[model samples]
Target: DAVDQARNFQEMLKFDGAVLTKLDTDAKGGAGLSIAHATGQPIVLCGVGQEYDDLMQFDPDWLLEQLFE
Candidate 1:
């Protein structure tokens, strides 16, 4: 696998939002957060469980709505 590719992609990016899969299985979401931030990316998505597609996409404006809601 291209481990370097992930790193390279991380390095070249400025600050793209990201999503991490398998968060339940993942330990404290540390690795995913680390990798995303390490690549200069902000995590904007997360998985809630072990389903095939149990993802939660964080919208930037969602925060605004929540605050107003």
Candidate 2:
């Protein structure tokens, strides 16, 4: 569904990258990665909490650690 949504958005917008949210949850966050891959766009930012202040630059190392740990 995320991939589908990503594709739909891509069709509708002229954006450069994605802002993935909900990284603080139990979700593995793979959908974000998948969307990036599927759309050929980088993840420019990520949300680690419920606040706007929690938004941060995308970090591949952190995602790798989350996946492997």
Candidate 3:
């Protein structure tokens, strides 16, 4: 549901990139892949925690490794 909502927003706004939040809580991160695929946009950043400094740049290879882990 959230992924679809995000995809719609991305499509409507034509945003440059996606910022996936709450990554620290999403252990599997299946939704992240779905959103990325559906949006057809690069995930430029990820919010790992509530703190501002917890955000990190999204790397495709790194994310793939994490997903498999």
lDDT scores of the candidates, listed in order:
0.62, 0.89, 0.83
Q: Which pairs of residues collide in candidate 2? A: none
lDDT score, residue 49, model 1? 77
Candidate 2, residues 28-54, lDDT tens digits: the string is: 788898999989999999999999999
| Tens-place lDDT digits, model 3, residues 1-69 | 978797789878988877889988996677887887888877889988899998999877877787788
How are the candidates ranked when ordered by lDDT, highest leading? 2, 3, 1
User: Candidate 3 overall Cα lDDT vs. reference?
Assistant: 0.83
Tell me how far the alpha carbon of residue 23 in candidate 1 is from the true structure, in angstroms, after superposition. Answer: 0.4
Q: Which window of ten consecutive residues has the lowest lDDT sum in model 3?
A: 27-36
**Candidate 2 Cα errors over 4 Å, as ranges:** none
Tally clashing residue pairs in candidate 2: 0
> What is candidate 2's CA lDDT for residue 38?
89
Candidate 2 has its poorest 10 consecutive residues by lDDT at: 21-30
Worst 10 residues of 1 by lDDT: 58-67
Predicted candidate 1 versus true structure: per-residue lDDT over 1-69, tens digit per residue: 233555777667744766767765753555664676466667788776777577778554643444455
